[model samples]
Target: MKYLLSNLKIDINNKIYLKDPESSDLGKRIIEHSIQLIDDIGFDSFTFKKLGIIIGSNESSIYRYFESKHKLLLYLTSWYWAWLEYQLVFSTTNVTNSNEKLDKAIDILTRTIESDSTFAHIDEVTLSRVVINEYSKSYLTKEVDDENKDGYFSIYKRLVTRLHDMMIEVNPNYKFPHSLASTVLEGALHQHFLKNHFKSLTDCNQKVQPSDYFKHLVFNALDTKT
Candidate 1:
């Protein structure tokens, strides 16, 4: 899978950036260091000037790639979803059984993330943490409606649709496939956040995983045996 993915690129919406960060070294540095900086200081405190100092580049150089920090967040979150979509599609493509396919999709969506070697500049593990901690900031804004119209959230919506389709395959009679699908995706992120920050609010911990809880929730909701 790594070899196959190495040859592929995770595409993000072009409108999210003024330039393609993957297209140049300095651009890539902006992305690489930005992830580290954001992870270290949190999104609210992150700024292009701070990132510029860390990467030894002028703040203006960073703007050439992204219009603002908000757009950068959009790029990161979009990249993560696209990468996960690749994993979901590749892992489940050959599975003939509907139950097994849905099982794999849930596990892929909810399980803890690890670093992917395919993109050395991007630490997926750290990126996942950023997504878990800061993804909502990308969309919880007044401009979100316009951004959605521009297809900035298409990758994420497509991922939800994939899960929705799998749910329908597993249980044709299920009435809320789209809602259940979005819940599993969004709820998994929320559960991970709770497990990390508000431990008392969640049952997932060292032994039980968000994937485990979600699998239980999904199967029972579909009236199917896991």
Candidate 2:
């Protein structure tokens, strides 16, 4: 776990910040601490008071950066998306070939699951509940709707669109369009994470790894042409 956290921190220092170095650094630390807190206490138990205690800063000091808990969550979600965009762009932008692009996309997916500890402590069931709770909130609901927006949502849009276009190139006869694939992929992930705790009446292979299974599902589903 220690090793994983260390490796994940490699390129995170710079991107985690905005502009002002001090506040940026402080925000970064607060975020790092917050992630740990979230993993430890779950999002429900998370509060500015707890974060202030962990970061050695007063509640007022933390509030200076994020006006409210909701705002902080929004920024945290934005940061997660931004970080994902960075990883995807870093791994794929240099490649011109469509196939290589797909491979890089898969690589990013696998690496994130393997390396990041943020999701390690979260069970699928808990994650799903968190998603539902977020949807109940207005700002968070907007973030979900705009997950495909080109600029703020570029990383997400670019990845899905690129893979979708590549799927078309690989197999014109492929029945699933990128949009559908995106829906299935995300829905499956959400369900798997949130529903893992429940017992299944139907026999299923629970041993199959999530990351690798996703890679196979994506490539195989798109392999109709090539």
Candidate 3:
């Protein structure tokens, strides 16, 4: 767990923020409060005005760090994916088997998240619920093309590419490594959403973990017995 050192920083895209929130005290406060607010009220109802009251800062102060609420949402989602990439790297670096590495990666994506004590201001567990519920709002917007062009989605894509690369290493003839990698991620989020709101759509039972289903889906899709 050396990767959980106090100084760990996840790189978010510069285009999303007017100023790097992690670099200043007030900026960090904004991020922390934003996470709590978004989780409490949901992203669509969350606003800098409400956040300002909670953080004891005016809306203008929050605006200095983010252009708009949408940008803040993008920043948060981007931060989560980048942080997940870091976790993936740290966890898999010492593992030797390609298939085992892939399994580890899949489990990381599908399993419940725990707060990393490395970053004092970020509550990864709460941020994860926000991600499962609200991360889609970051990209399911009219501005997605412009946002994509600005490199807002690179960290997530890079994470998927890393897993896809490992899949190819495990099976050179695999035809849809990219598809399977992305599916495991999106599918996990969707399953969590279902478990929260529409229980009929998911089987979040005690014994059958989502990771188990995802592992089967991935290994079966790859035509490999694990």
Candidate 4:
């Protein structure tokens, strides 16, 4: 699996970036530092100029890769989802039982992230933190409808569809597969946020993981034994 994943390339929507950040050293640096900068200062305070200072490049050079910080955020979040989709596909490909496949999918989606060494330039762990902290900013905007039409959210939607299909496989009679699949994905993020900030609002803690809660929720909803 590591060998297969070492050669993996996560494709993002072309419209999300002015240039592909994986194409050159400068471009990769833009992506690498941008993740760190965003995680450090957050999406609201992150800027190309600040990132340029960190990477020792002119702000305009960064602009050559991403038109704006918002677009960069889209690229980052898109990359994260695409990478996660690969993990999901690889992990569940050989599971013969439908319920087991769905169980693995939930684990992959809701579990805390660890750094992946395959993509050395981009830290998956830090990027996951960025996604948990700022993913909503990528789409919660007036331009989201237009961007959705342009396929910026395709990878994310496809991921939800994958989970939705798994839900149907587990329980063909289930009426709300799409809604439940989306809720598992989106709710995992919300739960992670609450676990970190509003501790009283979430049941997930040191002993209880978000994945545990979600797995229980999903199995019960499907009338399946965990």
In terms of lDDT, which candidate is strongest?
A: 1
* Per-candidate local distance difference test: 0.95, 0.53, 0.87, 0.93
Alpha carbon lDDT at 2, candidate 3: 48
Clashes of each: 0, 4, 0, 0
- Model 4: which residue pairs collide? none
What is the number of residue pairs that collide in model 3? 0
Candidate 3 yields a Cα-based lDDT of: 0.87
Point out where model 4 deviates above 4 Å: none
Q: Per-residue lDDT tens digits of candidate 3, residues 106-170?
A: 88888888767778898999999999999888899998998899899999899889989878978
Question: Candidate 1 on 1-226: residue-level lDDT in tens?
Answer: 8888999988898999999999999998898998899999999999999999999999999999999999999999999999999999999999999999999999999999987889989999999999999999999999999999999999999999999999999999999999999999999999999999999999999899999999999999999996
**lDDT per residue (tens digit) for residues 1-226 in model 4:** 7789888788888988888999999999999999999899999998888998999999999989888999999999999998899999999999999989999999999999986789888999999999999999999999999999999999999999999999999899998999999999999999999999999999999999999999999999999975
Task: Estimate the TM-score for candidate 3.
Answer: 0.96
Worst 10 residues of 1 by lDDT: 114-123
Better of 2 and 3 by TM-score: 3
Instruction: Write the residue-wise lDDT of candidate 2 on 1-226 in tens digits.
Output: 3443335532222222333213466666676676667657766688989998998888777766666665555555444444555566666667787666766665554332434444443232333334333423424455555533424334444556755775676667878767644653354444344434543521223554444555566667776311
RMSD of each predicted structure: 0.5, 6.4, 1.2, 0.7
